[model samples]
Target: MGSKNISITEDAYERLKAHKREGESFTDVIVRLTEDERDIMSGFGAWSGTDKGDHARKAREQLNAEFEDGR
Candidate 1:
């Protein structure tokens, strides 16, 4: 595998080191930190269903009414 060298300030280095576990390399910590497993498609079509669409519309209407009343 290929590697790159970058510089970090002492404070940044200390923060990364603080997250390091026993017998774990800084490379492992970096890899673990940079990996993202959040569902990218989670909200892509979340309101595609009829029920969700209706619920969202109602919520928006309620919010708008409340704001108009406050004003």
Candidate 2:
């Protein structure tokens, strides 16, 4: 694999260092943090199968009523 040298401010460097585990490199910490974020949406697509559709419809009706009342 190829590599590049990037620079960060002291504050940014400290933040990354804080996230690094024992014996882990900055690259590892960054990859771990980013990969963790990707898993967030893994089950979000299943929302339609739950009560989310009904909840959304009810919320929309409530919002519409509030808007009509304000008019």
Candidate 1 local lDDT, 1-71, one digit each (tens):
99889899999999999999999999999988888778885775465564546777888999999999995
Each candidate's root-mean-square deviation in Å?
Answer: 3.5, 3.5
State the local distance difference test value for candidate 1: 0.85
**TM-score between candidate 2 and the true structure:** 0.60
With a 3 Å backbone cut-off (N, CA, C), the pairs that clash in candidate 1 are none
RMSD of 1: 3.5
Clashing pairs in 2: none
Best by lDDT: 1
Model 1 weakest lDDT span, ten residues long = 44-53
